[model samples]
Target: MENSTQINTEKINFSLEDLEQDIWVRLVTGAVKSRNPFHTPCVATMDKGEISLRTVVLRKALAKERELRFHTDIRSPKWKELSLNPSISALFYDAGDRIQLRVKGKAVLHYKNDLTAEAWKNTTSSSRRCYLTLHSPSSFAEIPTSGLSEEIEQENFTLAESEMGYSNFGIVSIQVHSIDWLWLNHAGHRRAFFDYTDGSFQWMIP
Candidate 1:
């Protein structure tokens, strides 16, 4: 008898549009579901001739615009790197589901803008604590430290106190150019590529 996984695999073997839709579904779910593997994707950027990669929380995924959004500190190195070179790449993998998504895009920074304003307004006090750090991320410290003050570290700050972090808070919006989706299954592996710039979708040997 065919198991549920086999039955589900058969359903997934549908039209290209269906596959594309599924990719977006995963992305959208990742933004809201913190436990999801895709919730935090590894983002890559070019920094002074070096390839820099960091994991960031997925804040939003807009299917219609083919864009992904994430919050970051304006003082972070990755922010400066992306500002200098918009070219970016992100990787998402779900071991349980045996799926991987490799995405390429251009990132645009948003600060002191409508996007940042709205994002900061919705951000919780606990989440805002990181932005209130005394020193920027990646900076060397004399000893081990979180770069945050004791008051902020204890989550003793209120919404009004957290407001001070807005100046350092920023957002990175990635305009997706392409997506390479891979699904690994014991029976067979499937790989597909979708290019938004050229509006092309093709399946490749896996």
Candidate 2:
């Protein structure tokens, strides 16, 4: 549910420019508000001739640069897959607002770099705990486990202890190329496409 501070930006009278700005507004909101539907988006990538999809938290959105950022474990398959094929897509939807956004881009990984260093410095110990795993994300286990060590699983590690996970932490920056936006309503639906690569935008039949 939207908070009291949320404004009504999905009205039918909205223009293309308004819709584009609203999309960024919602993305920025999702990054800070866990309750927002856009907080988690379905990210798709090409992996060895196959399509891989996963839900990722929206860490940052830069409207001017046409980029979206996410954090990941350097050992994760998604990281390696993206390294092999940078082509990626992201899907976001808000049922309450009846809006959908399909974003296409290329993924750029940052590991042990200044970008990752700054991001790690601002990360909380709890969030950093995700990188303290004993095995890779999809590694097979003899028994069910959280992939994290008992100490990390129990959240007994101190802030300094969490620093060990920083090496496994990495950033995935999506250099957005285009966006397909759709709005559903009882009266009628609206759709539009915006391409940053060529600076082309147009309304489409919904």
Which residue pairs overlap in candidate 2's backbone? Answer: none
Instruction: Summing lDDT over every window of 10 consecutive residues in candidate 2, give the lowest-scoring window.
Output: 1-10
Best by lDDT: 1
Each candidate's clash count: 0, 0
| Segments of candidate 1 deviating more than 4 angstroms | 1-7, 10-12
Off by over 4 Å in 2: 1-11
Q: Worst ten-residue run, lDDT, model 1? A: 1-10
For candidate 2, lDDT tens digit of each residue in 1-206?
Answer: 14522336445676678678778878878777888888899999888899989999999988888889999998999999999999999999998888899999999999999999999999987898889987877889999989888888888989999999998999999999999998887888889999888988889998
For model 1, which pairs clash? Answer: none
- For each candidate in turn, the TM-score is 0.94, 0.93
Q: After superposition, how far is residue 176 of candidate 1 from its true place, in Å?
A: 0.3
Put down candidate 1 lDDT per residue, 1-206, tens digits, no spaces. 11112225644566678888878888888888888888999999999899999999999998899999999999999999999999999999988888899999999899999999998999988899989988898899999998888888999878888999999999999999999989998878999999999999999887
